[model samples]
Target: MGRLIRPDGLAVGERVRFDGQVRLVLAVTGRSVTLSDIGGTPRAVPPALLFANGDFEVVDSSGRMPLPPVSLLETLPQAALERALWWEGHILEVLNGLPPDAEAGTEPKPQYAPSRSL
Candidate 1:
């Protein structure tokens, strides 16, 4: 229903929805991508899974991505970064009645919980 973005098009700090939560792209390599939720817990995944999983979609993206903090080119502003994380927490709370990445929340739907389904 909207423009589809390929895995290779993802950029660090971009917000995406996957696995029933908001996540941020931490790093992207030719073979894999590192993603983190609002809690900053990182997960490394093969690039193809980002789109193949069918739950993946870019939520927020600017035409240009800022350089990682280690880079000298440019860094994302603290305010903007905070805003993204803030939204993740807010979304999680609204969806599950718990804080972002909290240990306890509403049980995930069988379709969304891989171990509970196929």
Candidate 2:
């Protein structure tokens, strides 16, 4: 079993939520965190704004969480966010049943359609 990662413990290539957007951890330092969107583009937000009221999560890549929902826009795309949330809800259901091995459906990745050239 692997431990879940969190924002304060982020690493290179890991994901973190800022405002409603999901940003990957490009670099971390003693003073601030630098982030990029799912499309691998740098955002213009001040590094300190990450502390604002919003949900933060470390995108799991252990093959269980296929929908890592790391967005770049100020507000994540509604459809993409919904898909990620639905997968999370299913996870909760399995945890409550104690049948941890029960596999979740092979859902498509929750990333939004890219609007720019990478």
Candidate 3:
């Protein structure tokens, strides 16, 4: 078995091939890598799926190859942003159950409230 590679280490705009398909490396981390499909959709792939190193190339629409700076936040689309926010909310809910920290002794705010009418 191959060791896992950090997805965040991959150069932005670096092309890579995985599972017999080609994709652009958007982000890399120790556990997984984020890639952009040919259609420009971002997908997360585990290191196990990455087979060949040079199987892909970095190229733009003009075929000129260049590596872009890694910006994970910039790569997130509206839908992905929403999903991340939702998951974060769930995590916060779990954290709220724990005892308050020394700095702050209040619990998290309620998620929902009864609507008041005039």
List per-prediction Cα lDDT, in the order shown: 0.64, 0.52, 0.51
Runs of candidate 3 with Cα error greater than 4 angstroms are 1-9, 52-118
User: Would you list the clashing residue pairs of candidate 1?
Assistant: none
- Which candidate achieves the best TM-score against the true structure? 1
Off by over 4 Å in 2: 1-8, 38-41, 44-48, 61-118
Error of 3 at 23 (Å): 1.2
Deviation from native of the Cα of residue 113 in model 3, angstroms: 56
Which is the leading candidate under lDDT? 1
> Which ten-residue region of model 1 has the weakest summed lDDT?
64-73
* TM-score per model over all chains: 0.46, 0.36, 0.34
What is candidate 2's local distance difference test score?
0.52
lDDT, candidate 2, 19-58, per-residue tens: 5776666666766677766555566444445544356556
Order of the predicted models by TM-score, top scorer first: 1, 2, 3
Q: For candidate 3, write residues 24-90 as lDDT tens digits.
A: 6767676777886654567886665563343433333232123332254457897876676566555
The superposed Cα distance between candidate 3 and the true structure at residue 74, in angstroms, equals 16
